[model samples]
Target: MPGFVHLHVHTQYSLLDGAIRLDPLIQKAVGFGMDAVAITDHGTMFGTIEFSEKCQKAGLRPIIGMEAYVAPRTLADRTAQDNKELRHLILLAETDEGYRNLCKLASIAQLQGFYYKPRIDKAVLQAHHEGLIAFSACLHGEIPRLILSGNLKAAEDAARWYLALFGEERFYLEVQHNGIPEQTTVNEALFDIADRLSIPLVATNDCHYLEARDVKAHDVLLCIQTGKTIHDSERMKFRTDQLYFKSPEEMTAFFGHRPHTIENTAKIAARCQVDLGFKGYHFPRYNPPGEERSAEEIFEEQVRSGFEDKWRIILQKNPDAERSRYLERLDYEIRVIQEMGFSGYFLIVSDFIRYAKTNGIPVGPGRGSAAGSLVAYCLSITDLDPLVHGLLFERFLNPARKSMPDIDVDFCINGRESVYKYVVDRYGGGEYVSQIITFGKLMTRAVIRDVGRALGIPLKEVDAIAKMVPEVLNISLENALKQEPRLAEMAQSKPEIGELIDICKVLEGLPRHASTHAAGVVIS
Candidate 1:
């Protein structure tokens, strides 16, 4: 009864659209002694890695899910003819297959159905919705839209469709109330439909950020997103002052009259028995033909070939620059690559890059520590030469410690798929290659700012106070206030300032959502 999980959350993985910061949100949830939390970021699972990593470290149950935008029809609907826009759908990975389906669904949504946001159609859902728990999402959710349009029968029909896809036990009616009039109207009809259909009901706060007061900054953020002034009535919006994270106590109080709704939240959590394990690396595959050579052999060939070519460059450039310098570096790099058992990784990257260059793909000159290797230069993995650029090969491969050497190759965004395809073709693509997952945690400062604003903080005051704290990434407001004299002075001089920083200190660093990294493709 005391511990409650945040079932719906959005961290910055919602990008600028979500104000929640991961560190603060997770910390706050723990501080409040909450049991578990769900990260249902809008559209993409970009934050999954960060969120899950932190949650495991902090001993919190991390629920992985996405607030998907449903495409009106199939994303393959190629007629430029305007189609009725789709609704919001909440998809949670309940099993390994569900997680995989979620990834494919998210990928396809971005690749094929990107209209206003990443989206998937009913057809796509029909294919991959198995093993996923479905929730009828925010007011913009499909069933709510039907009810809002004054069609109770239509709303029931929509619920029936989801119930059929996910089964009664796996699908829940997501009811939220942020004091919006539309929410009130929809809840009434939603409950009616759930009762008629014999479907379960769950309560969600539709948390956009961490705190209520953050609503204003989030409003300002909305302004930033749309290029609209804060005063515009025509702007697309959240439409409520009440979307901040509420404590279990507060949540219970909000649904005091409807205790069943509050109880249902815990019931849904009980039904959601998901255990996440980070047992193996989700490496992108480096395929090779079984008849030609084993993957290991192909990989070793690339490294040996790369080292010889690098020796050539060094010998040519510094005919007398010390042969020991070239040999010592090459021997060390090769040894480390072999020891880590990642010759496959190096070869896989090299093969694709070689193909790209041969096809005139205009790959990046170099980036990261890989730019510092002579072997990389000679093998065409990178254009930068350590001998010329005075780069360090140790940065790429350190003999002192072993870690995967991350060499990112960038091509024109439009033609990057060809490069991806080449790698998939060479390395066993589908089974071997898998994208890494990350998560977004809520943190202090941001959450308190959100809570303060939701309860109502003047914008000018919030800005002035936020400016007083020194800007340091990854430090909580509590630490910032203690370390910085300026923040200490400001808090002492102003009572409201003290309150603002005080509350943010409590809510700092909770896992508010999940999202994917931009280019953190893991190659094993």
Candidate 2:
């Protein structure tokens, strides 16, 4: 039997546009007997780590890819029209090199190429084309748009350019069937170009949801994204409901005439193998000039020196406290930290905290389980002494459990930026460090308001309806409606309210926006 794979999948990380959640999506793929699946979310790799982990757990090979928005001109050009005319390009990481390049491209897109969307131009693609497999995306892809515009020569020229950039073996002609009339035209042209150019044709569904029945829910999500109602004819929508993840049998039935296209998906899936370094921390190395001490040695020296300072202060408050117990606890923590290869992480964090305090930045007293570590107290990472407070070292970090130690540090709001700047300057520069990305999801109250506004409901009515939802964490609209009978009664009585509630139910829990993480910074 010829196995089939879905090479183009969009999870909820596609923001408001994609309706499929990661867990259910991977489970469905496994249920369908799929050995491999790909996640090509829009413009960001935010879900890559989660998707990869879930897929691996489900016994499915995870393909890390992104459906990138390509700028019409240079990424530096942010003219309104230039931003508006961005196209689609799909890049899949095939190896470790490809994964690194994918990360670089994604980071650069967010940091530098962000206009209306995080976009990359051809130059950026050419620069980071190594170890990546390129796919001419859907209707919005450059070649297909040119083909639809009747510029067959230009389309061929564009295809040739990509073929040259990503070698012929690595670049593929992607064809999708969503029952759109233009798709037929594009597929025909793509076949002709592929035959002439010696490029393989890979069949994909452009899946945005798990099953066929999810089309309505996915459509409602699109309406939420565009701020339009289902009644609005001019709003963006799929031409047909065939865009969901299809089983191998269904895909073969759809494209049986060209079995090779279906088979190519499996072939491509086999080629892409990414190893995400899971459960591993690559902490930055702290190299103090003219010092030969290892990170562990440096850390021990600092801990001893800092303890002398802390011990003097402790004697003034309680002169009878035993020093031997504190010393034993600190020695145990140092052994555990060194064995775990986290000595450098502790050293790096303490250095920054010291810098902040010496330069007049207000630091918070130790909070979280991290206050339980005696080493942290000695290093001045926290102001509280663990021994005097009888804080357990195992609470902060345990040899029984293997996980990274999370130390929450609070700095004054205004001084936070200065601390970050100092770390960046001390480490290397902006090129070596970048802020982590964070996502905002469409919560229960916000979804109700958004759907109400999009449906042209009055603000007062929306506010009243939203107030019916409880403030419980992770509460769903269904649960809220069950708890508050008025909401169910209103939905049953009024058609508009019923429609708004239905749409909001589908749009709930989807990602609404993205921003930089508050306290996370990565240095490499």
Candidate 3:
């Protein structure tokens, strides 16, 4: 049995649109004896690293890609008509250069091309097409749409244009079967076009959920996404229930007559090889003034001088205090920091904190494990003294862990923006800095309410059902149902309640949206 690779699948990081989660999705792929899978999340690479790592752990090759929203005109063109019209295209990374290009595209899409969605125009794609393999995506793709609209020549022209732009070897005509009547039409046209143009036909299932039974849950997810009830006459819906993670055997059965379509998936999967640079830290380069002292020397000098100043302040208050203990602890922590090759990291953080304090921005005393570091205290990165507090420096940064130390700094709400501005100014502004991304998930109670609403349950009833869920962090729907007997009884007694609970259970813990991380800003 020849295995088929999933080149166009969505994970929960696709937010409300995708129901399949990363861990279970990867596990399912491995269970089906799949050798490779690709996550083409909508307009973002948020899940690429996590998906790649999970796939590697499961002994499967991960193809990194995105189902990008391609703007009809230039990305800068935001006319009312153009704002709502965007086509779909799938871009897979074939090398490290492709991965970098993907990042650039995603960043530009979110930061500049974002109107109703993160979008990129063909111009942007042409500029960043190096090391990438592109697919004329699902029915929403330009070629497929053109074909479905009885525009065969236009469809062929569109396919030829992409083939020219991405190069003949890097472009593919994608075919899918999700039980939609229009898909059959599109696939037939694609086959004809592929035959004429010598373009390979790649089969994809467009997986949105893990199993066939998940169709109902995925439907509810779409309703939640569109703010509509399932009973609505006019609402966005998948025309068919065939969008599950299909096995190689199932895929072969679906496209067996055209075996090459199935085989091309494997070929495309083999071509993609992305390294996420997980082995080491890519810390931003710290440019020291005048080159008089290296970053390490300047870091040490600052730490020593700051420690002496603190020691002098303490000496004035308590003359009999032992300096040897403080000095030994400071030296040990400094040695550990230097040994870890984080001297520049410490200096960069300390420099910003100094700037914040000097400008009258109220910084917190200390927060998280970072307060445990004596070196942090010496550099004024934290105000808490580890010795007095009996905090272990190893907790913050240990030789055994060998990971980058996490230092979470809290700034006063009113002054936070100013501090961010100062960082941007110091680091050469937006070109060198950007905020990190954050994702929001479908928590147990929230999912229950959402599912109930989508199922057309009354708000009062939905609220009552949601209220039965225990207010506890990381508590699952199963745990809540077990803990609250009344909720279980209601689910068993009422058909609506039972359906809502079942749907919520499937959707729980899936990501609902993405936003900027509150406190994380990347310098470079």
What tens-digit string does per-residue lDDT give for candidate 2 at 146-198? Answer: 99999999999999998999997799999987899999999999999999989
Q: How do these models rank on lDDT, best leading?
A: 3, 2, 1
Give the winner by TM-score: 3
**Once superposed on the true structure, which residue ranges of model 2 sit more than 4 Å away at CA?**
77-85
Q: For model 1, what is the alpha-carbon lDDT of residue 294? A: 58
Q: In model 1, where do residues sit more than 4 Å from their true spots?
A: 72-85, 256-260, 267-279, 288-291, 301-336, 352-401, 407-524
The lowest-lDDT stretch of 10 consecutive residues in candidate 1 is 505-514
Give the alpha carbon lDDT tens digit for every residue of 77-131 in model 3: 8988786568999999999999999999998998889988999999999899999
Q: Better model by TM-score, 1 or 2?
A: 2
Can you tell me which runs of candidate 3 are displaced by over 4 Å? 288-292, 321-328, 388-390
Q: Comparing 2 and 3 by TM-score, which wins?
A: 3
lDDT of each: 0.73, 0.89, 0.89
TM-score for all models, in order of appearance: 0.70, 0.94, 0.95
RMSD, candidate 3, Å: 2.0
**Candidates sorted by TM-score, descending order?**
3, 2, 1
